[model samples]
Every structure is written in C-alpha cells, then in structure tokens.
Target: MLSNRYFTNGIDIYFDNVCGSMLDAVLNMTNHGRIAVCGMVSQQRLSQPEGIYNLFNLVIKSITMKGFLQSGYLHLFPMFLEDVVRFYKQGKIIYLEDVNEGLESSPIAFAGLFSGRNLGKQVICVARE
Candidate 1:
C-alpha cells in the first residue's frame, strides 16, 4: 500500500526492510505501533553494521519490535504464491527483479545488491530449463 503514496496520519505497521532508518521510522510511528525487521541489506556489505539508537521511543509509544527471516514462513509458501500470482494478474502489484544468469555471474549479482546497482529483487540464476 506504500508503493508511491503518503501516510496522512502516521505509520501503523512499519516493516524495516532496509534496517538503516529505525530512528526515523520510530519517530513517525503512531502509538502502539509495531515494527517487523525483515531484511538488513543496508548493512549486509558493511564489516560493522551500524547500531540503532533511540529505542526509548518504543517504550514511550508502546511499540513492538521483532525480527524474522523468510524461512520462518516456509509453510505458507504455497498460499503466498497463490496470492502473489493473483495480485499480479489483477495488476495490484508490479514485480521487479535483477537476475544474473549463470553461476559465474553470481558474485557480480550479489555485489550489485549491496551496492544498489540492482534495480529490484536480486537473483543469481544458475540454470534455466
């Protein structure tokens, strides 16, 4: 829903996919908001990931913060795929991905992800049938 729009009031469920803007996210979050930390691509390439501060806002605003990995939802893959396909067909979503074909190009693709060179979902395709 936040593709190219603005929030009138404030954010409700903030998904921290980038992991570099916790301070700003917390600042704009409504009371009792929740944060789901999924990806940390911003700090993936760094030798030392940047530390997050101002966590007291979570207490003051009564926010909940949690981290999760994609594998955690492995059981829901089929249902998720069905929904995604239906949404795509209905034109509710636009899928974008950067695929590097061949195992030899995986290094380049992986590097492109951390460097922001890839435009969308980074994928290293080892084979095609």
Candidate 2:
C-alpha cells in the first residue's frame, strides 16, 4: 500500500501512522518536505511507540514534523470557530457519525474508539442533554 503512495514525486506534507517505509521514502526524496503525524498504526503493542522517520534525513532535508492536536490551538479557538462555522455553512466540512441507539450502547461506542471500528466520530444515543 505504501508503494502505491508514490511519494517519489515529493510532497509538501505527508500524513501517516507507523508506516516506516512511507516515511523513509518521503525522507529519501530529493526535495524537502513536512509530515503531519496523527497516529502510529504500526506500533500497537508497544507501551511507548516511536515513528520510523530518520532524524539525520529530516535534518538534512530541513523537514518539519509536527503533531496536530486541538489543545495546541486552545488560545485560537475563537478564530478557529469563525472559520469552522463558515466552512460548515459552505458545506465544506462534512461529518460522519456512527450513532448507536440505546443507553446501553455507550460501552460499545467507547470500545469502537480504541478498536478503530468507527470510521468517523462515534456517538451513542441516550437521553438528550
């Protein structure tokens, strides 16, 4: 699957999870690039997992690696909300929800979070708050 990515063309940014070959290929590319890390899909057993990207290559290429988390922009929430609402209104940001009916479904919904069974956001239907 990584081979099909064809990162040989060089990309400005790459997002991957624990796919060392993909990261390695991106690093090996002649042009500089950046990678956005969401999760490591390959390292499921390790208590503390690490990415496969080579530090030497990253330094040589002047690539930037960054973590994307909402908390990092807590201070920018107000500005983010303004843009988010505009995007939502324009129908640019579409959300997929897995809604399991019944109060007892909370356990199942929570389990999906860890198992990756939920393709998008997972929600359990209970009494409306």
TM-score of each: 0.55, 0.50
Q: lDDT score of model 1?
A: 0.71
lDDT against the true structure, per candidate, is 0.71, 0.64
Q: Report the C-alpha lDDT of model 2 over 1-129, residue by residue, as the tens digit.
A: 232354435456666554444456556544467778766544565576545556687788788888786567699999989999999999987555878988898897776665445544678788776
Question: Evaluated with lDDT, which candidate comes out highest?
Answer: 1
Give candidates' CA RMSD values in order. 6.3, 7.0
lDDT of 1 by residue, 1-129 (tens): 232234557667766666654334444577898888888777777888777665787889898989999898999999999999999899977546778899999888877666546644788888898
Count of clashes, each model: 0, 0
Candidate 1 stretches greater than 4 Å from native: 1-5, 82-129
Worst 10 residues of 1 by lDDT: 1-10
